[model samples]
Target: MSNYKFILSGGGTGGHIYPAISIANELKSRFPEAQFLFVGAKDRMEMEKVPEAGYEIKGLWISGIQRRLSLKNFVFPFKLIDSFLKAGKIVKQFKPTMVIGTGGYASAPLVKVASAKGVKCVIQEQNSYPGIANKFLAGKAEKIFVAYDGLERFFPKNKIIKTGNPVRQDILNVSANVEEALEYFQLNKNKKVLLVLGGSLGARAINKLIEKELNFFAENNIQVIWQCGKLYYEEYKKYENKNIKVLAFLNKMNLAYTAADVIISRAGAGTVSELCIVGKPVIFIPSPNVAEDHQTKNAKALSGRNAAVLVKEVSLDSRFEKEFKSIITSETRQKELSKNIKKLALPHATKHIVDEIEKILKTL
Candidate 1:
C-alpha cells in the first residue's frame, strides 16, 4: 500500500471532468492505497459526475470570468478568495502528495493553493488551446500534460508534456463486431450511417441546424444515428424515423462508432481523442459556448492536417450537407480521414501520465 494521497480538480463541463476522473482512476488502479479527492464548482456537472464515478469531491464557489462586464464580475474576486481559502483548508487537512488540475474554473483555486503549499502539482490540458485557468496556473504547475503542440506559446517548454487526451477504454475497443453493432442499433445494413453528437448537455445551434435539415437524410437515403444530448432529446424525439435513431445518450459508444460511416460532432478534446481512436471520418462543429474557443482550436488541429472537416457554427446549416455528402458518399475520403486521424490516437495516455507521476516520486 502506497500511503500517499492525491487531490484532483476539474469541473464545469464533461470534457474537463471526465479526463480528470480517468487519470484519477488510472492512479488509483496503479496505487490502490492512495487516497484521492476531487474539487469542482458547486453547481457544476462534476459535483454529480465525480461522485457517480465513485470518488469524493469538494465544491468551490468559483466560476469562469465573464466576457462582458456582468454583475457576476463584481463578486468574482470574493469568490476566488473564498475558493482559494477553502481549497487551502482541504489541502491542509488531506496533506496530499500530489495535486492534479484538469483545467476548469474550480481547478484554478485548488491547484494554486496546492502549489503554494509546495505539493507536487500537474495539470492536464485537453485542448490545443488551453483555458484561462490552465494558462494562469502554467508557471506554478510542476508539470503540464497537453494534448497538442503550440501550447508552448501559453505554457513553459520545460514543463509541457505531450501525453494526448485520455478517453473511455470501451470507445477504443470499437474494433469488435461491426455486424453486432449495426444490429444493436437496429440500423439498416445497406445505408451509410451519419452519427451526430453534441456532447452531454447538447448544443442548441447544432440541434437547430439538424432540425432545419431533418429531411436531408431521407432525401439522400442516408441513415442517421443522432445523439441529441439530454437537453434537446425531448424536443427532437418526435423526428425519429425509420432511417433515424435518436438517443439522449448511448452507453455503447463502441457500437455507435462502429456503425457510423461519418461523424458530425462538437470537437471537444476528449471527443476528438475518442474519434481518433475510433478512426472514423469526422466533421467537427465546435461549440461556441465553451471558454477560450478551445473546441474550434481542437478541430483546427485535425482539419488543418486534412484529418477531419470543420464546419463553423455560423456556417453549419449552409455547408453541413455538402461536406457530409462528400465524406459519407466517398469511400476514398472516408479511408483517408480514418487513416489520418488514427495518427493522433494515444490509447495509452493514462499509462504515460501515471509514468510521469512515478518519475516525480523517484526524483523526490
Candidate 2:
C-alpha cells in the first residue's frame, strides 16, 4: 500500500511545470512509497516533460480564456465543465491524500474540485504577482506557498507562507565545473559567454535584436550560448557560426547557466528562480505579450533591490548593448548582483515545500 497519494496540477508554461515537478520529486525522494499523479492542460509541455521526469500525468481539456473577442472564447464554458468533471474523476480514482497546484491555466479545475471534496489542497505560487488561477484557488487552499514577499495583496494573508520557488536540484548542486560545462557546450574557455533565452518559443523582439547585434558580439570578442527556441529557429538558423551556439531548445540549462557570465533572459518566474541560484548578472527583457506584464514586475522586484538589471522589450534596440556592456564589464556590479540575488536563492526550496506537505498530511 502507498504511504500517501498526491494529485499535482500545473502547466501551460515551464514556470508552472517546473515547480510542480520539483515538489513531486522531493516528495518521492522523501517518501519512496508515495504515489503521484500530475494533471496538466492537454497539449502543453508538461504532458511530455512530466512523464520523462518519471511521474504519471493526466491531461485536461483546459485552455486559457481568450481576453480578445474570438471564437476561442465560445468554448470556454464547455471546456471548464469538461475539465472539472475529468478532474473529479482523477481525484476519486487516485484517492489522493492531498492536492497541490503550482499555478497555470490547468490549476483552477484541479484544485477547485479536490478542495470541494474536502481533501487538503495547497498551491505554490512562484511569482510576486499571483496568476488568476492561483488567486482563484487561494481562499480554498489550506496553504499558499509563495516565492515573493508582499503577495498577501493577491491571496489570503493568513494562509500565505513564503517558501520561495523550487528549482531543479541539479542546478543547486552544480558547481562551476567550467571544464565540463565548456565541453557540454563545446565552447572555448578563453572567451566570455553570454547566454540569451526568450524562453521555449523565442520572443520575436529579442531574436531580431540578436540578429542585429550578431556581428557586434563577434567583434567584441564575446561568444554566445543562445537558445532561440523552436518557433524562431528557422528564421535565425543562418546566423549560426563559430563562437555562437544556437539551439532550438536547451536541454542542458544547468551548463548554460554555469558557462555564461551575463544572462539576457525573459523574466518568467521559472527563469528568475533559476537565475537566482545561478547568480549571474542579468538583463531582463520582459515580454510585453504576457497576461499582466508580470515578467517586468518580476524583473523590477529583483532590480529594485539592486539584484539585477532590466531592459524593456521596446527599449532593447537602443539599450541592449549599453546595459549588457555595463553589467558584464563591471566586476564590482556583477559581484553585488551575485551576492544580493543569492540572498533570494531558495536552495532547499523543494525540501521546505515537501516538509509543508508532510505537515498537512500528518494532521489527518
Candidate 3:
C-alpha cells in the first residue's frame, strides 16, 4: 500500500510546476516508499524543476499549438498523435496507481491516455480560468481540485473540490521573525520595505514599471527587495544601490515575505496563494498576455472581497503610484488587507490535497 506509484504531469510555467512539486512532496512525506514519476513536455521548465525537487521525470515530445497560423501549428497534430502513443506507453510501463495533472499542454496527452487505460486520474486547476488541458480532461478525471469558485460551469460540480492553490510549505510559515528577515536581506530597519516579484521567468511589464518607479520609491523612503526574475536580472541589476536589493530569484522566499511591508507582484495563481498566506498588503498587476487573462480574474477574486488591491498592467502608469501610496502610507489599510488576505489562505492545502490522494489510494 505504501509503495503506490504516482504519475504527476504539468509544466511550462512555475504556476504548474511548483504545485505539482508540492503535491509530490506531500505524498512522499505521507508514503515515503511511494514512487513518483513526473511527465512533462521536453525542453519545458518542468524537465529541469522536477529533478531539482529530487523527483525522477520523463519528458514527452510535446508542445502547445500556436494560436496564429504558423509552421508550429501545422505540426501540432502529428506531435499530439506521437505524444498520445508515448503517453500510452508510459502508462503501460509505469503502472501508476494514480495520475495527477496540474495544468499545462504536457498534461493533456498523458492524462487522457491514463484515464482511457482505466487509471484513476485527478487534476488540480491553479487559475481562476481552467486551462485547455484541464478542461479537456474534466470528464475523465476522478476529482478536480480547484482554487477558485464558479468553475462548476466548466467541470462536473460533483467532482470539483475548492481546496485553494497549493503553495510552497515555507511560504505558509512566512510569519516568522521579521527582524531576522530584514537582516538576511541586509535591508534598513528604518525604512518601509517593498518586495517586487514578477513570476519565475519575469514579467516584462512589471520589470519596466519597477525600473521607471525607482525614483518614486526613493522619494518615499522605501527600501526594496526586487526579484526581477532570472531573465530580467541583468537589465535591472544596474538599478541596485544601498536601499535596493536586486535578485534573479529569491531562494529564501519565506524571508522575502517576512521582509516585505508591501508587495507589488504579477498575479500568477501560485504567487497569489503565497501572497495570501504571507498576509502582506499587495498590489496585483496581472499579465494580460495569458490565456483568458486568468491572472486578472485571480486578483479580482481577492480584490472584490477587500482582501487585496487590483491594478491592471494597462492602468499602472496612471494608477499604480496612487494605489501603492495609499496602501503603504496607512497602517490601518495595511492591517486590513493583511488580515483579510490571510483569512483567504488555505495554509494546509498540501495536506488536504494529499488527504484526497490517500483516499483514492485506499480504493486502489
Candidate 3: tens digits of C-alpha lDDT, residues 1-364? 6999999999999899999999999999888999999999999889888999999999888888787788998888898999999999999999999999999988999999999999999999998888999999999998999988899999999999989888877776666598999999988889999999886678899899988999999999999999998999898899888899999988999888889999999898998988988889999999888887899999999999999999998899899999999999999999999999989888787788889888887887
Indicate whether candidate 1 or candidate 3 has the larger lDDT. Answer: 3
Question: What TM-scores do the predictions have?
Answer: 0.97, 0.94, 0.97
The lDDT for every candidate, in the order shown, is 0.88, 0.88, 0.91
Cα deviation at 223, candidate 3, in Å, is: 1.1
Error of 3 at 25 (Å): 1.5
Question: Which TM-score value belongs to model 1?
Answer: 0.97
Query: What pairs collide in candidate 1?
Result: none
Tell me the tens digit of each residue's lDDT in model 2 across 191-287: 8899999778888888888888988888788899889989999988887777888889988878888888888888988789889988888888898
lDDT of 1 at 195: 88
RMSD each, Å: 1.3, 1.8, 1.3
Clashing pairs in 2: none
For residue 103, what is the lDDT in candidate 2?
89
Model 1 regions lying over 4 Å from their true place: none
